[model samples]
Every structure is written in structure tokens, then in C-alpha cells.
Target: MSQHARLPLTLDQLWQFSLQYYSAREIKEACLHLQNHFHGNVNLLLMLKWLDEAKLTFAPQDWSKITQSLGNIESLLRDYRELRRKLKVHVSDSLYKETLHFELQLEKQQQTALVNCINSLTLTDCEHPHLVEQYCLQLGAERLVRIFIQPVSSQSHNL
Candidate 1:
């Protein structure tokens, strides 16, 4: 009952964009580097990419919930990530690996829920499209790259 189709906009579309832009093997390495070193939120990174792809923006009210929910999920993700890392040393134990895998799946589900929650909100015109780029700049995070557009020798590029 809000605006927009959903959080991800297009799962396949956004994923394709993320793979092409945010998580290309090289870019993903950079992103994960940013994540491990900077505490950046990959889901938020992807969400911002999706927003840009959909040419959408969130209202302040919408962002309040979105940001709050992201905070909660990020905390859980951090905890699980730490647990998984600790468990990694014990990978010879199938239990530890299973636990890590479960944590990974739970993190994915949480991310999916976050996206669904975002999709449930209302969107306004992207007043300053650059906000997507600047969203986490002040937080000392999100330095994975400002642009995600594929280089097009044939067409002028933008993402």
C-alpha cells in the first residue's frame, strides 16, 4: 500500500545490476574488502544500486523505517559473521560448518526481509540523484566505488 513495486524492484534485474556493478568478481572483492575493513553494508550497497537502477528515492519517513531495519539486520549480520568466522577454524567438525552455513542462510533471509520491507514503503522523486552516491559518504563507509555503470564505448555511460 505504499509506492513502488518492491524493495529489490527487480530481483533478477537488481541482481544483474549488482553482479555487473556492485559484485563483479573484481568489484565484489573490493566491496568485500570495504565490508571487512570498513563495516559497510553490502545489502544497503545493493539496495542503493537498485534504487538508482529503478530511478527511485525514499521519503524521509520511508527511510526512517528502512534505516532502522537495516541497523537491526546489520547488527545481526555482524554477530553471525563473527560467529561464522570463529566457527571457520573448526570446519573439520561438520557441526561447525553446518552452523556457519545456517548463519549464512539466515543472513540472506534477513537481507531479503529487509528488501521486502523497503519495497513496502513509499518513494518520492529522487530530488538529488547523487544522494544515492552520497548516502553513506559521511559515515566513513561505502567507498566501494561511486559509479556502477558499465562502460559503453557505444553509448554514453551512467549508473
Candidate 2:
């Protein structure tokens, strides 16, 4: 059986800590645990035991349940990307409008300073890189897929 629960922290406690300080180290620790035990060469019997105990604060329930299918971790990545693709197609139109509305609202500012401020907003400006990475990792290509596959008749460059 692979050692998964070696981390001293519980997922709920870890989540609270993450919210408090926006720390990635603790979250990374839990991710490492998942990667080591669940993503890597998982031992079914032990993995199940860990799964029952884990309550999966970070990963989705289905992901944890997929231990039996995890012959190769890369397979999960492929599946993740494919799922992202499908989500993109499904939600593209709505997101396209949302993005446009967001930008337009930002643009509508009468003051040049506000427009500049909005334009200056960048990923680097965020206080939490790990949160961004985790979100992107979760979101994958869904946003891109949606934007790319949006109805051709819709406005393109505005988004």
C-alpha cells in the first residue's frame, strides 16, 4: 500500500490555512500526497483506504474514485484536456458574451485613468499565483475551447 496520509494536515484544516495566508506550500504538500499515492503507482487496496479517509478536499470525488483506472497518470491529463475541450464547446457562447460584457464595462469608464487601470490588470498582478495555477489547471482549455469554438457569426475580436 502506498503511503498517502503521511501529511500531518487534514484537508479542511489545510483549506482554512490556504484561505488565511494564501499559502501554496501547504496546498502543494497535499497535492504531492495525491500525486505520490493517487496519481503515481497506486496500490489499489491501500489507495482505497486512503480515499475513504481523505475526503478529497482538493481533488473531485470522481478523480479519487478513479484509482482503479489510473494505470498511467498521463492518461488523466489527456482525459482532463479532452474534458476541457468538451466544456469549451458547451459554454463558449455564454462565456464569449460574459467576456465581452466585462471588457465593455471596463471600456465604458469615462476616465482615461480607469481605462488604463483596467488595461493594466494582468495575471502577475494577482496576489496568489497558486490559486491562478490551480484554477487554470482546473479550467484547463475550457475557456480557450469555448472562445475558439464560439459561433462564427458572433463578434470575434471584441472578447
lDDT per residue for candidate 2 within 58-88, as digits (tens), equals 2334333343243343454445435555666
Worst 10 residues of 1 by lDDT: 149-158
* Candidate 2 worst ten-residue window by lDDT: 150-159
Question: Each model's TM-score?
Answer: 0.67, 0.19
Highest lDDT model number:
1
After the best TM-score superposition of candidate 1, give how far the Cα of residue 105 lies from its true spot, in angstroms: 1.7
Write down the TM-score for model 2.
Answer: 0.19
**True lDDT of residue 4, candidate 1:** 50
Q: Considering every candidate listed, which one attains the maximal TM-score?
A: 1
Error of 1 at 21 (Å): 5.1
Give residue 64's error in model 2 in angstroms: 19
Q: What is the C-alpha lDDT of each candidate?
A: 0.59, 0.32
The residue ranges of model 1 lying beyond 4 angstroms of the native Cα positions read: 1-23, 93-100, 125-128, 147-159
In terms of TM-score, how similar is model 1 to the real structure? 0.67
